[model samples]
Target: MKILLATDAYSVIVNGVITSIKNLRRELISMGHDVKILTLSSNRHSYIDYDSNVVYLGSYDISKIYPDARFSLSYTNPLIDSILTWKPDIIHTQSEFTTFSIARKIANKLDIPIIHTYHTLYEEYTHYFSPSERIGKYLAKKFTKRIYHKSTCMVVPTLKTYKVLKKYGIDENIYIVPTGLSMDKFSIKYPKEELELLKEELNLPLKSKILISVGRIGKEKNIEELINYLTKMKFKNIHLLIVGDGPYKNTLANLIKDYNLNNKITFTGLIPNDELNIYYQMADLFVSASTSETQGLTYIESLANGTPILCRDDECLEQTVINNYNGFRYNSFDEFSEKLKLILNNNGLYKNFVENAVISVNENFSSTTFANKILEIYEKYIK
Candidate 1:
């Protein structure tokens, strides 16, 4: 089957939606299916990354509203002509923005079914464009209803997001498909020497208990809460390693300074996707305070690497992070600190969490399983 994935975020912009698309594409191809991505190009001119099976449309930087993202221009004649010629069997959209509009156009013209995945909770992202929360939520609900109702089927990564769509009055057929990870990518054996060298280069202490969080350092991530919690605890041998970069880096850095946590926290900025597993392997635990994730991919990635997760409680994590099973979840900073201390101090209990982490991901979040589920949906819609 020739499947086309349309998304506003891709390539240079690394996020969960892009990661899900990439993993699904990879798995589909490996299973003898053809997959192509239609996304915004970082360059002023659009082009194709044939090797990666991507069709990039021309776009202008809109980082002021969303960091490292671009707003695609009107589709050019050549680009549209090229897509029409490719003759995709179905259109699966990962966003509700510019590229999604193009997906609807192409699907309509080609007489193909359109499927969409609701990835982010737009209501939580109003801070980027609107100053008023009431106005932002109203706009977000309207936008969601408008775009989602056009889809033949909607894919949501969690039941939480599915409920949100239903509440917005979108009567489309919604399927709950948890995002899958290529577990091997995190499970692959790395060169011990290289891993040690990276740790040394990053100035990570050889003896400290490392708690790492991997994602964009954005306001939505609630990274400040983690930093503040760390400062209050003031553990001498514990360090927090923040991976990934975003618009909020400067603000987070200043917050760290104000709390006098310069030595307790370290930021590695953006690391290449292929090399990200090394950092996960080096951590004793994976931690997050962000409530904005629709499906937290980092949580799965960490578990895949045998690293236990310590995250704030949220609806999206209910299926993945079980309290006192694979990992612990907290509702407040005090609870988070208490849980962290318990896990860090109790070696036997921590070992159980680490063991369960691997089992949980293996049984539930395999990339092959994810692709198969999505393929089933695609076949159902294909005539």
Candidate 2:
């Protein structure tokens, strides 16, 4: 089948949604399917990368409204006429805003079905719009309903997001399809010398036990809560490595100084996606206090690299991070402190978790399986 995956976020931007799309596209191509992408160009000029099967529509920066966002001046892209000639079997939308409207327009022109994946829960990002939580959420719901109801079916990464859409009175068919990581990307064995050089460059002590968190540095991620909980713990040689950059970095940097956690924490601003696996491999544990994910690709990516997780309790992590299994979940700082000790203090248990972490990703989160599930949905919708 010829499938067209459309999104505003693509190769230039780094985040969970793009990660999921890259893996899906790679797997689908390997499975002998024709797949193409439609995304925004970084500048106000549109073009196509025939080699990568991507259509770049020109857009201007809209970061003031949302982080790393860009929107085209007009809904119609001049280059879109060429894509229409190709006539894809179906359109799969990875973003809800600009790309979504374009996808709907294309679907209408081609008379093909559109399947939208709900990658974000806008309710958690209320602060970007207004301080009033109730009003923000009300706006978020209205916006979500207006956007998603047009699609033939809606895809959510977890039941938590599914419940959110249902609560918003969205009547579209919703499927709980957890985003899959490309496991082979994390199975790499980097040279010891390279790792040592990275350690030196990042000012990481070779002997310290590393706790890494990988994602955008946004307020919604609640990274401050992790910093707060870590300060409360009376642990030894445990360093926190925050491995991404975003709007919240300045705020978090100030908070770190307030608590005097300079040596205890390190921020490696935006590591390249290809090199990200080594950070996970080098870490003793993957830690997160954020409950604001549709299904965090980092958690699965960490597990795929044989690193166990220590995260806050949420419906999203209910099945991925089982308590005392592959990882541990905490409801409070006290609970997080105890679990931190349990994982970091016990050598034998940590090894067991490392083993289970690899197994958990392989048994449940295979990218090929994810692609096949998506194909099934496309077949059902494609007339």
Candidate 3:
């Protein structure tokens, strides 16, 4: 199966969707299936290589770090031409962005099958725009219906998203293909000495409880609320490690200053993939308040690294981090904070969560299984 994967957001910046695509492409290639990625170009196109087969559609004067505006609005001819020339067996488009429209155009032109994956649940994004929530939801449903309805099949990360699509009258073939980090990539057999060396190198205290949150540091993530809640807490030996860089970094920094939480939190902006597991291993607990995550990969990744996760009440999250069994979940900030304190105080109970979280990831969310499921879906549609 020769697959051409298209995405709007492709950069060195840490993104779950891009990461998952790369993993899937890697696995597919490993399985002896040809796969190519088509994406809009960032500056320094020479810095990265997608082999000869991977196509760069158009080189916009876009920076690696995109601003708040939607500048990459129009699809260029080069992209259209690339799709025509390659003539893939199937086109798998990600995100409900401008690029999916291009995929739709190519599919319509070539009369080939297009598999669209609904990565981000748009209704969550609507809250950031304004106070009036109804309009945002209206636009989200309208746009979701328009884009997803055209595809031969729509792939979503969770059953929650599948249900949402059903409500929008998108009765098209919807497959649940949850994305996962390659366990082999993080499957380093660190000797006890090496593990100790890593702990020393990161300056992680042996007894200090480390909490990690990795994802886009944006308003939609509700990171500010997490920071505020942490400030109010009275944990004696706790360190908060905030990973990834985004537009809201400075805003979060200011809030940290205002709340005088500078000492408690460490902003390690965009740690490389190689060192990510070190931080994950160091963390006793992982927490994210983001209601926007379709499937929180970091939560699973942390759990896979033997760390429990705490997240807000969402269907996808609930499935991953089973409350009181694996990790914890709460309805509101107050509720979340209460649970956080309990997890922090009860040292004996922490081991159960850590063990269960790893069990959950290994049993249900392995990348190998995810890749096979995706390939099965692709084969079904393409054949």
Candidate 4:
């Protein structure tokens, strides 16, 4: 089977959507299926990289909202002819913007089914462009409903997302497919010397208990809550390592300075994807206060590396984190502080959580399993 994945976010933009799409493509190809990517050209000039199975459409940078994303101006891109010639059996879209509109056009032209995965909840991202929250949510809902109605089927990463769409009155057939990760990648052993070198390089305290969070440092992420909680903690050797960069970096840096907690928090602007697993492995625990995640891939990645998670309680994490079994979830700052102290101070409990973390990821979130589940969805519309 031939599959085409169309997304506005890809290549240079390193986000969960791109990660999920790449993993799905790799697994599908390994299973003897052909996959091609249709995305905006990262280069200033548009070109097609046939060897890489990618078609880059001409686009203008959209750095105001997303630093590395671009918006294609041409509704009828010149490369559409070449994509039509490839004759994909199905089109799976990962975004709701330019690439998605193109997906609909191509699907209508080729008379092929288009499957859409709602990755980001735009309502949570209103701060980027909308003048007011009310207007932003109303516009986001209208846009989501319009694009989703065109797809043959809708794929949501979690039941939480499904509920959101249903509440918006979208009566489409929605399938819950959690994004999968290459668990083996995280399990690979990094040399003890390399780990030590990384710690020294990042200036991470050797004796400190590392509490790391990986994702965009955005307002919607609610990272300020994590920083605030860190200040109130009674633990002395605890250090917060925020991994990733975003528009909210300056705001967070200012907040950190105002509280005079610079020593307690370290912001490692943006780490390369290849080296990210090492950070997760080096950490004693992974933590996230963000409530906007669809599936929280970083949580799964941390678990795969045998690091226990302590995250804000959200419905999306219900299937991933088993409280007390693998990790604990908290509803408020007080609850988070209590859980953090209990998990960090108790050596026996920490050991059990670490052991259960690995087991949970292997059994439920393997990339192979994710691809197989997606294949089931593809078959439903492929005819």
* Winner on TM-score (1 vs 3): 1
TM-score of each: 0.96, 0.97, 0.88, 0.96
lDDT of each: 0.87, 0.88, 0.76, 0.87
In model 3, the number of clashes is 0
Q: Please, what are the lDDT tens digits per residue for candidate 2 over residues 274-353? A: 77888888888999989898888889889988899999999998889988989999999889888888898899999999
Q: Give the alpha carbon lDDT tens digit for every residue of 1-383 in model 4.
A: 99999988666333678789988998999999989998887655677888878888888888886655688876656678888888999999998888998989899989999999999888988877698999999988998898788889899999999999998998568998989998767758677788778878889888899999897778988999998888877568998999998888999999999999888889988876767889988899999888899998888888988899999999999989989999999999889988998998999999999999999998999899899999999998886
**Model 4, TM vs. native:** 0.96
The TM-score of predicted model 3 comes to: 0.88
| Runs off by more than 4 Å, candidate 4 | 12-14, 65-68
lDDT by residue (87-181, candidate 1, tens digit) is 99999999888889899999999999999998988899999879998899998999888877788998999988988888888656889999899
- Provide the clashing-pair count of each candidate structure: 0, 0, 0, 0
Per-residue alpha-carbon lDDT of model 3 for 19-40, expressed as tens digits?
A: 7887788888888987877666
lDDT of 1 at 83: 83
Cα deviation of 254, candidate 3, in Å: 0.9
The TM-score of predicted model 1 comes to: 0.96
